[model samples]
Target: MFMRAGLTIGEFSQITHLSVKMLRRYHEVGLLEPDRVDESTGYRYYSTAQVPNAQVIHRFRELDMPVREIKAILATPEPEARSALISEHLRRLERQLDTTRAAVTSLRRLLGPASPPLQVELRTSAAQSTAAVQAMVDQEEILRWYDGAMTELDAALADACLSQSGPPGGLYDNALFTHERGSATVYVPVTATAPAIGRVRPFVVPAAELAVTVHHGPHDDIDVTYGALGTYVAEHALAVAGPVRETYLVGPPDTADESAWRTEIGWPVFRTGIRVSG
Candidate 1:
């Protein structure tokens, strides 16, 4: 039956829908073997009867089954274990597919034009109940230290650095992007009624009149947005006195993508209202 329906590698590939490179790899891996090889040119020929098995291997690999796992299953020579291994791989792939779908949906939301440039809003924001981690952070080390500090807070407290208890914020003492590198504190609100955890207590970032702009997206390109907002403020003659702060209204874990983040950038300023320069 096999010799009666023998096929060349190209014909086998067309029938099985697996690439020639993949067929070669399967041969090398001992998952599948060519039924014949030309003695002179070393070309391979596969029997059409083997096409169904090749299709099965292709489907399993597409589902992200590890090559080693596939080899083991093929070598097991048992009906039960092979079926069980396939089931386990299916469950894992389903979970990853769901996560990928969520990310796609979130990206779609973020792809829209950024919300209209911050309309200047003037209001005295009251001081907030704060939990902060202070550290000397170089630009390269900032993200690492932040992750560790955030994890520490997560393990120890109920509300975290980005979670809203009052107003979530961070105070940068020096510019990290321009490489002036210095200390910074990532702050978040705590439960007012509850007692402080260790040094995490009521810390104030000073209630002040701020010139704020709403940024709806990831923080990666936030500097451009900052420059625009700063230009707007400067044209209106506002002097930024203190550290610029970010109030995270939406975050990555809260949303599926980083692009879905919504942050309020507030530059503590002295000048207010639309002023005309004479």
Candidate 2:
């Protein structure tokens, strides 16, 4: 009987580098059924031809591919359909890898010695008319929404032949940070407001006094600047209830080099007569 069955379960496990336990689980899941079974002892056996399939499953599992997805890939007869499924999983893995790298970079910066104190200033901004896009958005989706909104604003300005008077900016409600969802606005200041287009519309940006600090480099560590600025406001100024404003003086839209980026983070405040400390 052993001579008739191609390989015992243990033999197949050794050749495929898969554990006997995993093979059993795969068999139970109908992922890889045995080629033959002994009627008397109910022993499982696999053919030598199944070695390649087991190895392929092992490689896919190493890449963290789901068993279900692997099954789908195997079941699909069309080469293109199978390739598409694998390609999509690879893309998802790439996105996860990118997020992990960014988190690692941020962690390194945070664990290093404290940097010099942030230089904060108090300034008054006057009311200005602009073309803007506003929406209620989730925190996780803000970046995507911002990119789309800014692109539309730029095209609308170009179509109307209007020149930007200042850098593009955003106003984010406090609830956005506290509750992870809230009203957000992205705007480009222009000499004259352009006609409403899609989510973009002619609007006025209200004036307010702000305690501002410039955050240099990529936005990955921008929260550090926001924290420092908030500390200064709590100590020296009267904090007002309003949306937080960010001015993208030099950003991805301006340069691909993140080190060259400059963002101005402003907290709404009422100026106290106290002088700014370095």
Candidate 3:
């Protein structure tokens, strides 16, 4: 019997830098099959032409691509389709990287010296009518809901020929934070009456006295500011049971730079001349 013209599995592994064990696992998963298999000895042989293919698989694995996805990429014949698959995976990796960066930033801020005292002011907000969208949203879905609601509010105002009188704001029920799900209302204040359309409705925001603080930069670390403001309210003022308010003073609509974004976080409060004793 004549042996096939190919490098043995060991030689292929040495050239590709993929461990022999990994090569066997990849084969088992149908990710990267050997060019030839000796029927009698069960020995695997790879062609020199498959070197680039093995290298490509190694790179994808390093990127944490799933074996199934790598197999799909290899099986795809069209260049455009293969590129699309890779691009989609790259996008997912980018999102994961962003999340990791944000978490690191938060951890560093927490571990560092105590942040400067929060600049909080007591202010009264007057009742106003606006175009709004309200929904019961889970904490994990808050960002998605906020974006959709804001867009809907914008479109509703435009369709009604109404001019926005103030920056966009949101009211988040305490249950949302405490229980991970609750009512959420986002609105765009308008001078004229807003007509009801779709999820957008004419809603009136009641007046309230708030202990407000400005959270600079991105929303990722906004919770730190929230904690500071809560502490301040607990120490010097009386907190009222009401939905928290957030006004986007300068946001994504105004600038692509997240560092320039400023959000006003308002905690409902009632000031009595008495400070709480701990």
Model 3, stretches more than 4 Å misplaced?
1-5, 14-17, 48-56, 71-88, 235-237, 275-278
Candidate 3: tens digits of C-alpha lDDT, residues 1-278: 99666999999999999999999998898888999998999999999999999999999999999988998999999999999999989977886776777677778888999887778878889998988899999987787788888888888887888999999899999999899999999999899888889999889999998888999999877887888889889877579899999999999999999999999999999967653332
Tell me, by lDDT, which candidate is best: 3
lDDT minimum window of 10 residues, candidate 3? 269-278
In order, how many clashes per candidate? Answer: 0, 0, 0
Which parts of model 2 have CA positions greater than 4 angstroms off? 1-18, 30-60, 68-95
Q: Tens digit of lDDT per residue, candidate 2, span 244-265? A: 9999999987899999999999
Q: Comparing 2 and 3 by lDDT, which wins? A: 3
Rank list by TM-score: 2, 3, 1
**Poorest stretch of ten by lDDT in candidate 2:** 1-10
Pairs of residues clashing in candidate 3: none
Look at candidate 1 and give me any clashing residue pairs: none
lDDT of 2: 0.89
TM-score of each: 0.51, 0.80, 0.80
The digit string of per-residue lDDT tens for model 1 on 1-278 reads 35343688888999998889989998898888899888898889998678777877888788788888888777777899888887888867775765566567555645767756456665577777666666778865665677676555554466433344754567765476567587777776765432355545446667877777777676555666677677776877775657777787777547878767888888777755564222
- Candidate 1 structure lDDT: 0.71
